[model samples]
Target: MAKVKINQPFTLLDTRVGVAERQTVQLEVAKLYTHTPMTIPIEVVNGAESGPVLMVCAAIHGDELNGVEVVRQLLSKVDAATLRGTLIAVPIVNIFGFIHKSRYLPDRRDLNRCFPGSEQGSLGARMAHMFFDLVVKKSNHSIDLHTGAIHRSNLPQIRGDLSCEMTKEMAMAFGTPVAIDARLRNGSLRSEASGLDIPVITYEAGEALRFDALAIAAGLQGVENVMRHLKMLRGRRRKQVHDAVIAAATSWVRADVDGIVRAQVTLGERVSKGQILAYIDSPLGQSEEAIIAPRSGIVIGQQMLPLVNEGDAVFHIAYFAHANSIVEQQLETFIDDIGPIS
Candidate 1:
C-alpha cells in the first residue's frame, strides 16, 4: 500500500483536504434550464495515515438507489481519524436523472454508457468527462454500486472483469454470494478505470427506485470487507459465511407471452433446465404460457413487476462451473447471516 506524506493535504477538484479531515466538495456538472447550477456532492474523508485511495460511488443510473443508501451508511460509519486512506464517496452521479427519479438524463441518454467522455460532447458526455477527470482519476481503486432497473430486483452479486487479478480479488473480497465474470462494455466506468490500471468492481442488488434492507446491509458489509482487504481499515477480514462463487456466464429468460406473470421461483433460487419459472396469464384469462428455464443456473435477477410483454426479460440466471447446490447454500447462509430485513 502506498502511503500519503505525513501531515500532507490530499488535493481533489483543486481543493486541498487536510489529513484526518472530512470535506464535501460540490462538483459542478451543469446548469439547469432554469439557470440553477447543478452539482454532484462528493464527500472526501482523508485519514490520519497514508494508504490507498478508494472511491465508492453510486447512482450513475440515478434511480438505482440502493447504492445511494449504501454510500450514505458507509459515510456515516467511516471515521477519518481511524481510516487508513482517503475515502471519496459520491452518492449521486446523475443529478438530473435522480431529481426526476429516472434512469436516463434529460436528453434521454444513459449516463452510464458515456464514460471517459469529452467536454465538447453532449450533456451526458460533458458530465461524464468532468466526473471521470476530477473524481475517478484520483482514486487508486473504486466500487461502483448499482441495483436492478425499475420494477426489477437483483440478488446481491459482484460484477467485474475477473480476468484482471486485482479486480478478481476485490470482487471476492466483497463477499457476495455470486461474482460474475462480466465483460467490460465500451465507455463504461469500469473499462475506463481499468484502462488506467485502477481495479474497480460493481455491486448489483435490490431494485431501482426502492430501498432494500438486505441489499443495503450486505453492500455495507461488502464495502467494509474490501476496505479491510485493501488494508485501508485496520481489522482482521471477516470470514464470509459462504465465499462467493464465480459465474462463467449469465443469461436472461424473457416472457413468452404478453400477460401478467406468476413467478414460481424467486431471486437466489436454484432451478433446473426446463424448470417452470413462471406462468404468464392473459388479462382476459383466455391464454396462458409457462416460462421455463433455458438451462440450469442460479437466479441472480428477476422482474418484480407482474405484468410483462412478450420478450420482456424476466429472470436472469448465472451459470457456474461449481455445483448449483453450493451456490444455493451460499445464498441461504448469506440470508441467514443478515437475518430479516425490516
Candidate 2:
C-alpha cells in the first residue's frame, strides 16, 4: 500500500472512528417482510487532512454494475493516510434490486424516484429517506452513477444541470466527450440534493445487468478527475481532461415500423439530419423501413435489442454546439485519452 500522511479525523454518517482508516459501516434500512434485516453497505475513507466531502455512489437501479466496479477501483486507488477530506462510497444502494437481479424492489418501485422519502412511506420510500438523511445530506458533492435501461447501451457521459458554475466544473472534469444538460425529475436524488445546493451529477455509461470494461474504466477515471478538481487528491493533471462537449438539446429517434432492425451506427457515432441511422426489415420479407435521424447530433445511447416495435425508441441523440463535426472529431480522441480497459 502507498503510504498516506496522517493529519486529521473526519466524521461521516455518524461514524467517527479516526482519520487515515477505511471503514465499512452498515446502515440497517428496514426489515424485510420475510423477518430478515436489510442493510445498506457504506465504505468511508476519511483523509488525514481537511478537504471536501465527496460521495461516490452506485447501483441505485440495482442491475447497473459499471458503477459498482468504478467504486471498487476508486477505493483501491485511494490512500486515506495521505488523503484529504472524506470519500463515502455506497457501491450498492439498491440491495433488494441487486439481490433479485432486478431493476426494482419486490414492490416494483424504482428507488431512484423516491428521494427525500418519508419515514412512514412505502418500503422504497422509507429506504430513500433513510439514505437521504444519513448519506446524501452529509455530502458536499456527489456523483450518482447509472447505466442505460435493459437492452440499451450508453456512451460514457456526464448528465446534469450544467448552468451552475460548480456543477459545470465537475461535468467538465469528467472528460466524457459529452456533457448533457439534464432536467431534474421530482423525487429524484439529484433533485433533492440540488435543493440543498450540493453539486450532484449523474455519470451514465454501459447497460444494466452487465459490465462494460471500457465503461468501468472511464467511470473510474472520471470520478478521480472530479476528486482531483475538488482538491481531494494531489497528482499530475490528467491529459485532455477538458474535452466534454455540452449538449443541451437531445432527442430520441423512434422506430417507425416494427421489425428486426440493423443499426448502421453505434453509440458515440455522429449522425446528420435525414441520415439513415438504421434499417428495419420485416420478418416476412414483405417491406422495409429506415430509421432516420430527426436532426443532426451524435448517438449517445442506442438499443441493443434488434427487435423493435413501431414507436419504440431506437436511438438517443445529443446535440452539441457543433454536433456534426467538432464533437465528432473529439469523440475518438476522448476514447483514446481514457485508454483501453485493463
List lDDT for all candidates, in order: 0.92, 0.88
- TM-scores for all candidates: the values are 0.97, 0.96
**TM-score between candidate 1 and the true structure:** 0.97
Candidate 2: segments with Cα more than 4 A from true spot: 1-8
lDDT of 2 by residue, 1-342 (tens): 956545566566667848778888898987777979899899999887778889999999999989999999999989987778899999999999999988998899999999999999999899999999988988899999999999999998898878778999999988888889898999889999999999999999999999999899889989988888888888745776655888869988999889999999999888888999999999987898999888889999999999999899999999877645878777788778877666
Report clash pairs, candidate 1: none
Native-referenced Cα lDDT, model 1: 0.92
Which window of ten consecutive residues has the lowest lDDT sum in model 2?
4-13
Candidate 2: the clashing residue pairs are: 4-81, 4-82, 5-81, 5-82, 8-48
Q: Highest TM-score, which number?
A: 1
